[model samples]
Target: MVSKSSPHKSALKEKEGISQPESIGKNSVAQIIQFRKQQPSAQELIDGILKGDKISLSRAITLVESTQPKHLEKANEIIQACLPYSNNSVRIGITGVPGVGKSTFIEAFGRFLTAFGKKVAVLAVDPSSTISHGSILGDKTRMEELVKDENAYIRPSASGETLGGVARKTRETIILCEACGFDTIIIETVGVGQSETAVHSMVDFFLLLKISGAGDELQGIKRGIMEMADAIVINKADGDNIKKARMAKTEFNRALHLFPPKSSGWQPKVTTCSAITHDGIAEIWEMISEYLILTKDNGYFSERRKDQNQHWLLETINEQLKNHFFEHPEIKNLLEENKKAVHDNEISPFAAASILLEKYFR
Candidate 1:
């Protein structure tokens, strides 16, 4: 049906044809895969951290958080090398109940510090998810400005199996931050509770953030966290809430009198500020500055650090022992059986636990 010339040339082929894009090169794919598998040496990480490199600091923290024995061993070497350069910064612990503007206040506070040329590092311990076993708020996403600031570094870690508000490796992480030339280290807890106790042990200053409420509620708690706080900062003190915040501050001040005098000889202070409006932020810093001057003059600062080191020594031992007992293969199998027996009341809960402990010992 076609002429010989038409069959070879065809008018349809004379029109413009669509062009296909080039395919991905195999070499590029191999290079990307190779980059993913590459890990920097511990000494390289240490050098980069000392030179104020954020990328290296982040990689080292990830190494510390890893569960692998090799990663842990590398993390230990990094920590040991960095230890000599740490403990030079002021460690501040910030804790509050949910919806109390902990993140907002911390952002404002951190911005204030960074504005004055202080390198700030915020360690935010996020609540762990029950289903995924991961962090609920990873990477300090709530503090947008602070997260973007060059002088401010924020690292969010999952609470994991650590019972307190902070992570198990948080103490070690602090050493790295200080080594990276951060003058102010801020730790934000998941929420205000038993976690406050854990944070109190590690920090030079413990600031409890609270929203304006009825004066009666402030006075309801006579001791506990109220005693541990070096300062109770009433946040959201703008416009309509200013009057109420003043009332709460006065109430908190009166309640603070009930606790015994601190060994540091510095009295607790109550102050109010607005994280939104950035009001009264400087005064809060001034109060903390005064505290530092007082504590340092009396030598309580160094003494307290010594005490914290001893406390951590014992805590690390307890943590390791508990992990060892719970992680053993034999213990894991026996624990499940004991749990079933205890549930069905075939054996008393205490006896079942004793048998498991005995087996673990055996």
Candidate 2:
């Protein structure tokens, strides 16, 4: 009673007179502004991306793909803000056998789609050398016409030892492209065996390209890939291979029937096309649209996307965990020692892995 009111009054006055923690707050704001100045503002870049500004989109993709810690934080913030504006674009993954002419197909398909007034973004994932960690970066040169098209945006990325011929950053790059308002996104994966499954997980539709007369169609690809594809296009079908292409298409069509139907409740189709002459490109696009309509009507379209998101989350977590494990100095030493042990036959491969894992947990 004697001091309660007095103390409260004094405290209020002291609080009003005292300086606050403005220095830290001011520094943070200044840092954010500086970071923004160093990188493109997400909102501004996103706006340009939506308007089909190729330069802005390229810059935005590069910002997202940057390895700088600060740039990564900004990229995350931008993606978070742009998430609501995303998911409006169609994502298609295209893969083929090494000589199946994936680059040619993408160029022809991209030009065809743009001709219909749709903006297309092509993201090519090139295989990186395990020894040098460098990529050939050849997509732009292969798709010269599409690269020059104002309505088409082409970005080539290195897989960097990642599985599935897709970059670890490809998913994030896809989000940036969608946020920027690309109507369609085409992910072109390096024609690696079995690893093509990675691209299958991210796309709304998976199209596999195979050249006719490559021996038995099944010989050219694993059965697992054939099962995963929504559509199979026998490429190089224009010249002397037309008959063989048709025969190959029939073989695939028959093979497709043996597998259990997709969980998406849609049947996969097989077709033939020649990417070099641009023959049957329009038909392939039409089939894609038809598939979309059928899936959307059946309520499988959104469900498929949700499933892809879940798969991506798991993939991202596993990738990060692997990176962290390999980067730890102690783990690196252990791995090196284990490799030597295996090479010298001092330990079985399984035992070596077990020893390393035991130490990893410690």
Candidate 3:
């Protein structure tokens, strides 16, 4: 008996008359692997990104997201080089519950911006699966047209175990996108209605995206998120849903009025839009433009960016300290011992943590 050789199939002894050929040729596979092996240097990536090269921009962001220590140093160099070019872009953080047409709305909005020569970069952060550790949403695929646009860039990232993880990487990616000449940065965060969210702290404008019929949904959302919203866009207002959308707009506007005025002195606006029909898309941009004007004139724009910088400064410190603490060889071994000790009630959790911290410091 002869053996069958099909890369797609498990190795088996041939009993049949014929065997299928390899799905992909070995030469093709080698070429693909060789193409992927071409990684540009940090300086090259930075230079290409500054020249508005999307490939380089994406590559640099990949470095930023990598957990490897070597990648960290390169990521830092790219960020430090790009910092001066950043903070000039309009950073918008958008959030909504699942199935709210967030992707559809973004495509319409992004296309509208690019119509006027604005370079838009979208960072859609999907909730990472605890088991798979991969992004569940295909935002780039959803925003197909926008993804094809030369002026628009859509990069979806996975939200890790905590909000802080998303913040550090996404915030750094924003800098890279801005340096890549994307004037408008849209960060789509995971879930709805979290208080003092990482996205809220990093963006200049926070927009809450929602559907028309969400009465029960409102209860699930926290007031803190509503107060943080610069605008509420009720999407999918086409057909019979128009009336419900308008009603939702009115309800959101009223609810917004219930809160005290924003420090920006710019009132939060509620508007209805149909992401499918592109209705009210321009009006939404007009509203955002009004906001930008008001914030800039009142000096809130620059002040808010400064505040965000300070917040990120502290956030980075906390993240690095935590990483440093756990990465210590003594702490990793001691942590396991401490965990067992605490589980056995042989030592208090505080005492174990104290012992680990002392060892880490030493």
Top candidate by lDDT: 1
- Which runs of model 3 end up more than 4 angstroms from their true locations? 1-28, 192-196, 216-221
What C-alpha lDDT do the candidate models reach, one value each? Answer: 0.88, 0.83, 0.86
Tens-place lDDT per residue, model 1, 105-182, is 999999999998999999998888768887666447789999999999999888886776464588888999999999
Where is the poorest 10-residue window by lDDT in model 1?
A: 13-22
Candidate 3, 1-362: lDDT as tens digits: 44576346666666698654576567778899999998899999999999999999989999988888999999999999999998788988888888998899999999999999999999988777779787666888999999999999999887777653366888899999999999999988776434238889999889988887877334525687888889889999999999998888877877887889999999998898999999999998898889999999999999999898899899899988998888888788889999999999999999988898788777
Candidate 3: pairs in clash = none
Model 2 TM-score (2 dp): 0.81
Q: Which runs in model 2 stand beyond 4 Å of their true positions?
A: 1-38, 41-52, 218-221, 329-362
Score residue 20 of candidate 1 by CA lDDT: 33
Q: What is the lDDT of residue 247 in candidate 1?
A: 86
TM-score, ranked from best to worst: 3, 1, 2
Q: Weakest 10 consecutive residues, lDDT, candidate 3? A: 213-222
List runs of model 1 lying over 4 Å from the truth. Answer: 1-30, 214-222
TM-score of candidate 3 on Cα atoms, chains taken together: 0.90
